[model samples]
Target chain A: MHSLTRSFLAVALLASVSAAHAHRTWLLPSAAQVDGKDPWVTVDAAVSEDLFELGANALKLDGLSITDPDGGSVQPNQTSTGKYRSSLDLKLAKSGTYRISLVSETAMASYKLNGEMKRWRGNVADLKKEVPAEAEELSVSTTLGRLETFVTAGKPNGTALKPVGSGLELIPLDHPSEFLAGQPARFRLLLDGKPLPGLTVAVVPGGVKYRGVLKETALTTDAKGEFTVNWPTPQMYWINAGYPARVNVPEGQPRPPMPAKRYNYSGTFEVLPQ
Target chain B: MQKRKLLLTAVLASALPALAAELSVKIDIPQLAVAEYHRPYIAMWLEKADGGQVTQLAVWYDQKKKDNGGTKWLKDMRQWWRKGGRDLEVPLDAVTSATRAPGLHALNFAAGKAPLGQLAAGEYTLFVEASREAGGREVVRVPLSWPPKEARSTGSKGQEELGNVTVQLKP
Candidate 1:
């Protein structure tokens, strides 16, 4: 009887301690803010699975809430990866204000994309950091569907750049002589000064082949006009688009044979692993 | 040992498609990166001089990365992307290694199989693109005459970052 009573007390004490520790480590779920017009931030949500810091956000996002300054909210769930996540149907389409914030009752730390929280003086509740604006933002279109909203930006009256009719852009990287597989090459672009949106671009080696094999992640173009497509193995291809032909005919012209331009931009390279 | 034999048998089976009438080709690139650093993924493919997809051979990338980040670099690899970036998913093991640096890389086309050299007769362009991590990008093209994949191996280059690239190709 005496041991039973002591065990009960121990259980109650342990539960309380656990609750306290969880509360102490609690942080506000973080959200990135994109302010242009139809401000929609792409949530990479790459949660680090193992953070060595004792009080780090252990990558579990069960109790997180995303709130926009314009009175909008969303709950991002984890995808196949431990790091990546996406919010469901939340749109920040307001004109006057734009900000997406996340705070975890658990950790109390908030993350805003492109925000540098260095030299913060007081508490995080009123922390103010300026998020840099994306110059030329473009919406994405995949076999899945078009990005939820149109990409918008700051500039007072700049007309919006329409999405590529087929949601595609022709990217060209130039180099002198042929590129040997292991040797590095270089080139510039005709649209260097133009404001271009982020899109999936590819390298088509041969001037003739359509629907050639692709190198993964290598298809995406970063903010910089730079792109990288790893060779699946060493091979050959041509230049073209990633999407199916969706453009309409002008009442008379036949469908262009997938726009394979010889445009003096052709070559070969060996693809041996490093 | 049985697995090795099976793999060998599979390679032989795949090679059966190459029992063609003529032609032979190969590429050589030494000094590649195989560590935990950033090396650009490269792609090579064939097309008629008029610019159309013919065949896709290889893509080098790390499958473990996110958001198609590994394949995202294909844009700079202009030629291959045009023909089939959207369609091909080169199996991870085919391109996986530690990491890659710069130097020589080579692919060979043997006799009686994919007679790459014996093209009946016409103009063709072989293209390549490099999408590096820390540096800039580049694409090179070699203009070849018909029948023989051996044509002085002419090529065009890009800008300041990717060092001088030279394609020493033959028939």
Candidate 2:
């Protein structure tokens, strides 16, 4: 293999190792909070390690949907996709919290001979599933990714923000609109309405432009399915949390412990400076 | 393993009410020594092991108070407020009631019913958060399993405002 290609594979392996199971699909707004007078927020959606830096690559926005504070739909004006990033612009008309949600279609592929999964950008087919006879024996499956974020104009009016998605969900008990810097914020995580304990919820300050290794402060929820994160500083914070689904083998199938399906849930809420 | 699996399938397919599960919660309100003591606002809800909120069972406050002033202190039950309290309007029927006097108060709901019945089968935590006016705040959590594969119950004790909280899931 060429030196460049070999180094690229090394980086991918290193990134995957460091992230563990971090197929985090997050929706990041240019600004989580904006002035009501001229409220316009740019949103970036991606399946990546640090929200939307394109460290892995850009994810397609086929199932992208944005709802304004008044429950009206906000359309993306300009959408441009690059090797690493996909950007869109949203016009914020009303003065409330706008919810952005993107549901990626399921992308599946066979595992490498060494049992490691291959990385691919955008949506693609599982060649192994298509031609089973010609494909490898063992395979990997990733469930659809669900990403969501919230932005606000004026003070967070507490409108249009509800946990209705079917993925691993984080429901902010405190209003995300009223987050203050340095104050602790509490959130509850649930999968199918059940409190998920021991979830590693990470909070990253700023959007993709964060410098110095993308420092993220993470905390694990207690037995009560709750976590309190004290934002180190007041800035636009992207809080990402998720878990993998259990793998159930069929009744008569040889149980070699199949790989579990993974799901990613993410959101962005700003903690304004006091 | 096979027998247990078959039994689980049979129970899931059974139409008999004997398979129905019932959730009962007992919350103790401690009588504290303080001047002008008022009953604390209490909120109870079910959450999955992953922290997903199921359905809220009840919120006890002075709903009958004039000007809806009792709700102003509801935020003091900080855990419940972020879980689902802030999303709801005050005086939610069947879910909101006046605070109970200091004692062990019991609330029951049958499975396949509105609140508890709406719950998807899973292991859950019953969170009971209490915040009193001119008093301390406390929260207690008890683990519970629904669609009672087997009859089970769990309980926990609170520090100050709240006392013992017991959750029983009966088949």
Best by lDDT: 2
State the local distance difference test value for candidate 2: 0.68
Kindly list the per-residue Cα lDDT of model 2 for residues B52-151, writing each as its tens digit: 9558899999775569977877886788999978888878776899888889999998876756666777788889888765345677888777677756
Q: What is the number of residue pairs that collide in model 1?
A: 128
Positional deviation of residue A216's Cα in model 1 after best superposition, in angstroms: 24
Tens-digit lDDT track of model 2 for A1-274: 4444444454444334223443455666777778856788887766654444566677677778887877777787778777776778877777788888887645444333343435532243544344345333334445555677777888776556666646677788787777897788889887766888976766766543333123456678789789998877776666666465222233334333323355666677777788
Best-performing candidate as measured by TM-score: 2
> How does model 2 score by TM-score?
0.47
Relative to the true structure, candidate 1 has a C-alpha RMSD (angstroms) of 23.4
Across A107-182, the per-residue lDDT of candidate 1 in tens digits comes to 1111223432211122223323321233111111112111111112232111222112222222224221122354
Q: Cα lDDT of all candidates, in order? A: 0.35, 0.68
RMSD of model 2, in Å?
23.3
Q: Model 2, which residues run further than 4 Å from truth? A: A1-25, A46-56, A70-74, A111-138, A206-215, A245-258, B1-171
Model 2 per-residue lDDT at B149: 72
